[model samples]
Target chain A: MQLKTQTRPKVISVLVMEDRIDAATAIQFKERMRDVTKDAPARVVLDLARVQFLDSSGLGAIVAVKKLLGPDRALELSSLTPTVEKVFRLTRMDTVFTIHPSLEVAVASAASV
Target chain B: MPPQPVSDHDPRRSSLTLVFQADPVSIRQALQGMLTCPPLSCLRGEDRGMAELVLAEVLNNVAEHAYAEAGGKVEIRLDGDPRGLRCLVVDEGREMPGGQLPEGRLPCGPYVALDDLPEGGFGWHLIRSLCADLAYARVDGQNRLAFVLATGS
Candidate 1:
């Protein structure tokens, strides 16, 4: 899985370039995320607008990436497709990570703060 | 195109069976190969996405816990209807932890600390929540799990 990253004023949005995030791609996704987020700013937004299929393994990968970012830095997920959002809501991970409807909103919030 | 609502006597009901290796690649290939099915193909992307997500979780569970990545076979049977789809997964690798399914609910946890967050237990929760009906049985030395989902075609 290839991740696209854009660094703005306060937030760096990492756009996930994939349609499916399941068992087949979860490991690679985590590895790629670790590399992309190793030196990110204080707050980062993960843009998942194109991710239409996300399962448990994929969710775990996200959590693992969060841990890699450490305590001070924050990881927020944005642009969740309905299916991906359903998985997060069902697992109650929606409450764990801050969510936004779009990357623009997330970035704007970062600018506000 | 949308699939019409199905009845008991509807001729559109169809069944398919296949044996797959208990592995992620095989399970993914199996699901990918199913895109041509009528009921699944007719459903909207979100519904199909949920179905595929649930199916992938279940299959990965079998490969991880049951077969332990050594080697095993999973027999899958899909019952297709114009209104919905039912799937049966059978494997001989292992039984449920205590001969029963998990609570099928998310275990509450504090979302505060990074160490306290969960990573693995979410699979069964996702499966149980998305599926309409889920049944599990350990019969004749095989772990059989049957689940149904609405196609919303």
Candidate 2:
């Protein structure tokens, strides 16, 4: 559950460094997100470019992170791989969060807003 | 000469059997192995992804629910073909409650509260959505779950 965080102005982007987030690491992922975003800005963009696999447990963990951030802060996702996108699509979770096609786009949108 | 028969030994028809402890770490390792092996390795794009996701959900259920506190062994037998893969998972642990599978309804909706948002229950939904001919049975102190993952090939 290695996550790299970068803060820029109003938004912070956290890059998931690992290739897979499954049952084995969902809890850790959530906890790490909490720790990194504890005092961050109102918008958080999670870059999933490196993640190759995510199970339901992993998906749930991401949702948990969103809830943890509450209504004040937004948790946006970017660069979802083919399978990751499928999970979000099948679960209809893709509708819940703002999903950007790339990290640059996610951050750029944050800059504009 | 007559057309050749498609025997069980045909290279196109293959199966892989894996037996491991019912634990998250072990299940991860098993999934990695399966993806690298024949038939599963032969899958591509969304087909391969679906296989990994479905198997992960099923195996995780065994580790988290079936075994729970009482650790046990789990066996996975996968038969692969041009169309898709047939997966059978067996565990020598607790039977599914009421000896039946869950209905696997989606837990989220457009109006659910943020606090009430589900952190779980998505596993079965994913399994049901991606798998076909899904079946579960408790027999002779073992839980057997079978499903077919279509590769669209």
Candidate 3:
């Protein structure tokens, strides 16, 4: 459940340094996200490029993080691998949050907004 | 090059059986072992992804819901063919409520409030969507779940 955090002016990008987020690590992932994004700006883009797999528990943790962020702070997602993307798509969580193809695009969009 | 024929009796691609403690950490290791082995290892792209997702959900359910705090052991048998992999999961934990599987409806709507957004209950929905012929039975004192994950080949 390692996360690399890079904070810019308007957005904070937390890159997941793990290959899989499943039942084994979902709770740890959520707790880490909360700590990393505690002082996040308006947008927090989670970069999941290295994550090759995410189960339902992992998805729930992400959603839990979003709710933890509340209405003012937005939790966005970027760089979803095919399998991670499939989990979001299948659960229809894709429609709940804004998803970017890459971290750069997510940061750029956040900067403009 | 022509596609190689896949046979059920092929010596290199035989059914995989795994027995492990019903816990998250053990289930994770089991999933890794299953995916890297024959038949599952032979899957590509979406098919492989689906297999992992479905298996994770099923195993996690057994650990969290079925076993709960009581703890138990789970046995998984996977037989793969051209159409898909047929999975059988057996556990001695408590049977599913009502002696049946959940309907696994999508938890949230397109316009649900942020606070109302569901943080769980998506496991069964995912399993149902990714697998076919999903069935549950309580034979003797064990819970038996069966499903087929198509490779789309």
Candidate 4:
């Protein structure tokens, strides 16, 4: 799995090209997010349109990334598959982060904030 | 802790082995049976959640890592006493990722920082956190992951 990063002004976008985000892909996830967001922005959106599955580890990763951004920046999740959504709901993390239907919507929503 | 008395009709008093191909639905069914079968009554709601999380994560890992490229077989073994449950997942596919548990868990306890959670490193962390003991071994072209979850009486 490869984590690609792109910066657009106040928003940092991360694209995860993986069917599942588990222990194997979590570190690369963190490094890429950290590398892209070295300079914090007002909003950070992760485009998980391709991810079909996520576990607690994956959830923890996102939570860690959210913490890295601290309370100032907005962290938004986009394009979460149903299984992935189930995991978020199971862990009750859906309430912790902002989730959107698509990357465009997530980024746009973050931009609005 | 003392060994609790086994209840009548307890299935876990005897070792159980249930093997399923890389089918998610079947896997869940088997898990449902294994977790509920008599002696394992200790697995209630919260333990059910924990089992679901652990099973989903590990089985998905097997499906992707073991059978992603070419279909392969996955074997699940359950062994336990009245004290706790042990699950072993063995897959005949790619080799297990090589390395020790991440350095982050050096000081294990609650109040661990969420920010310190490594994005990808959460697999072992979650397995370690959810289970009392975890061991991994690659034997004869198979990745065997053993999980031990204690049910405090």
Candidate 5:
């Protein structure tokens, strides 16, 4: 999966350019995310506005990515589609990560810091 | 995983039973069929997400655990209407890890420590939480799991 990254002073935003994150793509997604996030800022937001479907594997992969980023860096999630958002809530992962309604909102919050 | 032809119709409650090879590609086809099924076509928003998520978890589990990297058959039966949905999944493979379904529990979450947070083991929890009723049974060398989600009625 191809990912787009935008760097700023406060946070680096990675846009996931896929519609579905399932068992079929979860591994690749995580691997690609690692490459994109290697040199990112401490605060990173995964913009998932385009993704409309997510399964448990996808959720686990995201959590793995967060752990890989280490303790100091925070991996935030933004622009979660309703379907993707439900997975986070049902699994209670919503509490684990800082979630935002949109990429702009997450970026704005980080910029203000 | 093997391919088996499915009849377009099943007489029981207008149910549809589709047998798929226990793999990611076949799982995706089954999911696509559910998303477009006439009875479930109206599913949108939270309901749609729940169905897709639960289905994926169950099917993937069969592919990952039951089959254990071997070829197998996964059967998915759907009986749903405007009010609710009942999903039955059957797999011809090894029994559950301990010959039982994973007891669903809320994961320790919203934690400050990364080590404390869990990455996997959330699938069964979500399945139990979203489905109004869930049951699992092994019959005649087949693993059967039934899930009911009440959309309105």
Candidate 6:
């Protein structure tokens, strides 16, 4: 699995290419993001188009990253699969963060800000 | 103690129990059974959604991550009480991940700030939000995960 990070202006967009996110990789994921964006004000866009499944641990890691961001920055989500999307909707997380249909829109919105 | 009132009954006594392999399909079936209490057929939309999402995540963790691809047996026991549903997942796998919060301070929900955009931490948040209690332990190379949710008051 590859987590590619790109910085455009103030935006940091990440593409996740793993079929599933669960306990096995949740911590690794948290560490990578924490290490990559250390103290940076990044409008992160997580592209989950390739993620076929997402378990609770994976969701926790995402929340952890959101916590790390604090009160100033923006954490955007994009390309959530239907099953994955169902999870967010079921948990009412769709109301918590900014979700986008595509990475381009996420980046464009970040750029506009 | 003297004979207790029916209203004071412990829901644990009414709980249903079952065991299954640590597979996604089996887990799904078990959850279906847990959510639907006989005469009720299947659970309603809300309860079914919660049960499916929570079980899918927990069981997937057991089958794929906890074992780390090494084949092993996982035992699941479920109890449905008037208080709510409780589940225990027992597995002889690698050491369990030390992911537990102190007492009642379980952290649940996504972070709003952009700077805190955690590149990955979101799974536990989902679990915490869906269930009333979640506990974990590693004993003699066995991982035991217990979760509980409350029903009507």
Best by DockQ: 3
Q: Model 3, range B89-117, lDDT digits (tens) per residue?
A: 99999889999899999998898999999
Each prediction's whole-model lDDT (CA) = 0.84, 0.91, 0.92, 0.67, 0.83, 0.67
Candidate 4 lDDT by residue in tens digits, A1-113: 57777788789888887776654466667767777777857888888888765675567677777888876887789988766776666444666677999988877776665
Q: In model 2, state the lDDT of residue B131.
A: 89
The alpha-carbon interface RMSD of model 1 comes to: 1.3
Cα lDDT tens digits, model 5, A77-109, are 999888888888888788888999999999999
DockQ score for model 1: 0.74
Docking verdict class for candidate 5: medium
Per-residue C-alpha lDDT of model 2 across residues A1-113, encoded as one tens digit per residue: 79999999999999999999898999999999999999989999999999999999999999999999999999999999999999999998988889999999999999998
The fnat of each candidate, in order, is 0.81, 0.85, 0.92, 0.29, 0.85, 0.35
Q: List model 4 lDDT by residue over B51-139, tens digit each.
A: 65677667766775667734467887777666778888888877755534343242223354555433343344445556766777888
Instruction: Report the C-alpha lDDT of model 6 over B20-77, residue by residue, as the tens digit.
Output: 7666556656655765652112244455455556666667667767777555677766
The TM-scores of all predictions, comma-separated, are 0.90, 0.95, 0.96, 0.50, 0.90, 0.52
Better of 1 and 3 by DockQ: 3
Superposed on the true chain A, the predicted chain A of model 5 yields a TM-score of: 0.97
Off by over 4 Å in 2: B1-11
The DockQ scores of all candidates, in the order shown, are 0.74, 0.86, 0.93, 0.16, 0.79, 0.19
TM-score of chain B of each: 0.85, 0.90, 0.93, 0.70, 0.82, 0.64
What is model 3's DockQ versus the real complex?
Answer: 0.93
Please write out the lDDT profile of model 1 over residues B23-104, one tens digit for every residue: 9889889888765664455567878887778778888999989999876999988888756788899999888999888886
Worst 10 residues of 4 chain A by lDDT: A86-95
**Considering every candidate listed, which one attains the maximal TM-score?**
3
Report how large a share of the reference interface contacts model 4 reproduces.
0.29
Candidate 4 accuracy as TM-score: 0.50
